[model samples]
Target chain A: MGKPPPISNRVRLHRMLAGDMTQAELGEAVGVTRHTIIAIEQGRYSPSLETAFRIARLFDVGVEDVFGWEEQP
Target chain B: MYQDLSFREKSAWAMGALALIITLFYLADVQPISWRTGEAPPVDRHFIKIAIATIVGSIIIQSVLAARNPKEAEAPADERERLALARAGNHAGFILAFGSVAALLHYLVHANGDLLFHGILISLLVSTIAESALQIFYFRRGG
Candidate 1:
């Protein structure tokens, strides 16, 4: 397995706040697969800039509110 | 397990299994003849049979999978799936290059084109299997 990306996201939390949206629903809204959403939430993948914007827009938040850079020591 | 897997992952597993079975069958059919004659067996009816089997089997397997998951099968690969596939292809390309080089060296040493042909063919088969395996790995590991 590859290392997880040095990125963090609140997609799962935001999904819940947004009427408990399911990963599939979020993925469908964002034009990605549910698996891709799962990977993003798990920190296994970093979304493209376009996807990041889409996700943030879907959640009614700025990209920075949804995603954060995890500083490595 | 099957239900948990994505369509692409399931396809990879199925194709990998098919490739493995075909490789074993090809070796079983040719190895005995090569042992008896003390030489690489010539391309013959057995090769043709294997080729036909591979083509037909691939079509059937793909059709069955698509039937089971029509929407997913019809959708184009997403970003992550594409990345995993490209990475698998990169690694498999190395294996193919190494195998081809080894086959060429063997042909130079033994002056046997037949063995060289079989060696390259085996490399292609093995690399295909490896590519599928790697794709499965990437899928499972969240790549």
Candidate 2:
């Protein structure tokens, strides 16, 4: 299994706060597939700067609010 | 079981499976004849038939898939999907080049023109299948 990316995200948390938004719904809003959202939430993949900005914009949050750098152990 | 997989992922799986099956069929048809004749088998009508069938079969499968999910079929691949495909193709290129070099070396040693042709063709088919399989793997790994 691949190690998780150093980036971490609160996508799921934001989705819950956004009136229980579904992954598919968010994906469509952000021009990505549900699987990409899932990967971002699970920290298995990191999005490009554009996608990151889109996601934050969709949630009405700053990019730093949605994503954080995970200090490597 | 694969319901969660995206349409592109499903297509990759189907194409990979088809390529593998076709490669097996081609080898089965050619190997024994080559063994018996001690030469490259005659370029048979069967080769053309199989080539056409493979192409037509892929188109039919892809068409059916697109009919089932028109929107997804029409959507272009995202950045991650494109990256996965590019990486897969890169690996497949290495495989094809290695196979070609090996085939050339075998031809130089055995002087078997028929085997060289068969080897290179098989290499092409194998590389294509490998590319699809690699794409599936990358997609699942979070592309």
Candidate 3:
């Protein structure tokens, strides 16, 4: 089981790159809930493949660019 | 509607609402009965209410499903939804089964009829709440 992190620097960076795209707007683009976008931003959860692809596509970047591994144990 | 969350999360929203309302209604009904009699009913009023409620709930659920996509309801749960539900159920089953056995053993040892009734009743209730909680968790976490 994974725990949620306090903040997702990746998502923060994504927003910065996009000129402050809100969660609902990101969710709408990715076909997910606003809650999910929030979760991603907060590191509470990760998205499925299709959604990841959608997000990456919207940001004009690869999935790896949008999501990154946390500093390891 | 928000796009592309799985159907299970949507169903969980409906089911969780039904579970909460029905559980509260059941407690409201059963509490008075238990208090007056000082005994839990041998039969499950909760189960009965859920069954009845689900009948209406299903109609409402189906209607919403139709409103969303008629074809979707006709199709079975998608792979992710099925996996989420199965995982949640599988996780919850352990507690449910343990609770039942513990209740039975308590009855065997103590032989308190009223307590047995309540123990089993509470077991069912706990299982239901756990199931709903797990669904919510799975919905929040991806499947």
Candidate 4:
């Protein structure tokens, strides 16, 4: 596996809060695939700015609320 | 197992397998003749057969995959998939360049046009296989 991106996200948490939304639902809402949603949730891939905003808007949260940077040692 | 994979990933796997099979078939068909003649075998009907097999095999594989996942097959590549594909292409370009240069260098020394042609053909085939492998890697590992 590749090293995880420094970005971290609470996409899964948001999905849960949004009536237990599935990754496919979120991906459909955000114009991506479920695999992309899974990648975002796992921090294996970082979304583009437009996608990030779309995801944040879908969860009714600020982009900062849904996403954050991991502290590097 | 295929249910868990995305359509693009499934396509990659299928294409990769096809390319590998074709590469092996090409080598098997040509190598014996080259060994016996002590020179690169001339391009002949075998190459025509290989071309026909590749085109037919690709169509069947793609048709089967698309028929199974029509929705996904129709969908355009999403951001992550696009990125992975671009990265895979970039890496594959390097492999192609290296193979081509090596083939050219071999030609410079051996001065055999037939061997040069075969060397380049093999390089192209190998690079295609490498591209598919790299795409699968990027898809699974995240680009």
Error of 3 at B9 (Å): 0.8
lDDT tens digits, residue span B1-143, model 2: 67788889989998988889888888777777768876656367547856987898899889988998898899888877888889999999999999999999999999887778888888899999999999988887876
Compared with the true structure, all predictions reach lDDT values of 0.89, 0.87, 0.68, 0.90
lDDT for B120 in candidate 3 is 66
Candidate 4 has an lDDT of 0.90
Instruction: Please give the lDDT score at residue B5 for candidate 4.
Output: 94
DockQ of each: 0.67, 0.69, 0.16, 0.82
Error of 4 at B19 (Å): 0.5
On DockQ, the leading prediction is 4
Candidate 3, superposed: residue stretches over 4 Å from native: A1-71, B1-5, B44-47, B71-82, B110-122
Error of 3 at B90 (Å): 1.6
Instruction: Give the per-residue lDDT of model 4 (tens digit) for B93-123.
Output: 8888888888899889988888887887788
lDDT of 2 at B84: 85
TM-scores, all candidates, are 0.96, 0.95, 0.58, 0.97
TM-score of 4: 0.97
Which is the better candidate, 2 or 3, if ranked by lDDT?
2
Model 3 CAPRI quality: incorrect
Highest lDDT scorer: 4
Better of 3 and 4 by lDDT: 4
Candidate 1 lDDT tens digits, B1-143: 67878889999999999999999998998899889987756578767877898899999999999999998899888888888899999999999899999999999999898889888988988998999999988876776
How many backbone collisions does model 3 have? 1
